[model samples]
Target: MNTFRLSKRIMNINRTEIADLIYNKIIENRSAIKTQFLKTNETVGYFFMDDLLPTELALEIHAKFPTTEEAVKRKNIREFKFTAFQMNNYNSLLEEVIYAFQDERIIQLISEICNLEAVYGDENLYAGGLSLMGKDNFLNPHLDNSHDKDRKRWRVLNLLYYVTPNWTLENGGNLEIWPEGLKKKQTTIESKFNRLVVMTTHQKSWHSVSKVLKDDVRCCVSNYYFSDTPFLNSDTFHITTFRGRSSEKIKDIFLRIDNGLRSNMRRLFKKGVRENPHQYKK
Candidate 1:
């Protein structure tokens, strides 16, 4: 679809009435939501809400997702998955649902629950969009890139909405957060259907996804919020750092050195040698 029409669809999705309804549902559970996030925020800073949207609507969005062949593949030691940000590549419903999280009311509610300030959603996507992982596909432990596309705002939080119906913990494409550190045991958050997970991302938040055990594809809609300040005083600019799992010692050492080299390159060239290709063109 054309950008003009796509923009209209996004706007329609955020019409005041609809936005208020979404806002109210979240606000009604605000106390519980805040408690859940605060309980973990001191360690890793994350929280999840099941049934973030109406199940039928969430299922419709998932049904509209592009197949693996239609999305871009990233298969390397760091991760193996499919991602797509170009809005035109998917149906209008997918675009609508993605931007729905960008709605100002929703943003305000999320910021309040997380006790974060000056949060802003990514419009160009900038590595925030749709992702899919089939059997054997996995993402290694890693920290997200520190800044926005322009290197202006700090990437503070990651918002992921899982819509694949009937997904379970045993399915294995769950989110793993290393609250204490990679050396310690990690917490597993199941990629449950129609769930929305919001997690803080700073210099030390190390997270990954377990390998998919089922033959099915797990699909997710992702978005990032940027801010003027780091989430913690200890936070600083860094590349998208990666590390091998606790079991892979050799790969861990190699990735540590690899991250150091990439960090150096960023220090010298603020924008890097080339532009990041993972962004919406319009």
Candidate 2:
């Protein structure tokens, strides 16, 4: 198994310290954060950090991780499935950092920043663990699956921790946010090392990961928080649809047809008649 070491200093900050940083940042820029996501300014807001993950821990996790199967489905003719490598069931130091994310301090800070009350998962650790993505893999633009285990609440926030050392823009594997609708254009978010991208996910939040250009894996930690209420003012049901970039014509058509079928199935069978195992449970 691949293995590496955790940093000696940064790892000692503890959960309380981390939470405080998140809280202070939110209070300091509450209005700006809210406007960034809600107003006409922009559909997405981003926050970056150079040391969110202790370098040693990040390196170690990256070394010891295993590659996951690329889950693929036909979205359209040229458009294919959201294929990528993922290892959610974490071992090594990976689990420690991921679970620490749910600390009450951090959650409260995130809730305040987004101007929403923080409600967490009770049945189990709805929070996710570590994940790794390799070359040629891609995640298509789609709405996140709403609700946690048992459909008890609405899943509102997505906290992503990217930890690939020396990951450069030229490498490609970037996070693409399609806030203004795919037909218009897309805003690409760089998956920089130690960067934490916390995004608002509701019925309208449409996002995806671009295809990786190199053979090196792009590793990340993925987490989600659930609330008793939905984030959107209007509660609507939309399937997790996928589409090709503006240029892929025939592929786009096929994906639209594929999305329609899945969407229709969900209408008839509340949960789409299939269990989505992508989520985290206790």
Candidate 2 lDDT, 13-117, residue by residue in tens? 444544554456556666755566555324544444445544555676566555554332334343222322233443435544565667777777777666678
Candidate 2 residue 219 C-alpha distance from true site, Å: 0.7
TM-score of 2: 0.77
- Candidate RMSDs in order: 4.5, 5.1
Worst lDDT 10-window in candidate 2: 78-87
Per-residue C-alpha lDDT of model 1 across residues 152-208, encoded as one tens digit per residue: 999988999998999999999999999999999999999999888999999889999
Report how far off residue 8 is in candidate 1 (Å): 19
Q: Cα lDDT for residue 121, model 2?
A: 33
The model with the greatest TM-score is 1
**What are the Cα lDDT values of the candidates?**
0.87, 0.64
Q: What does candidate 2 score in Cα RMSD to the true structure?
A: 5.1
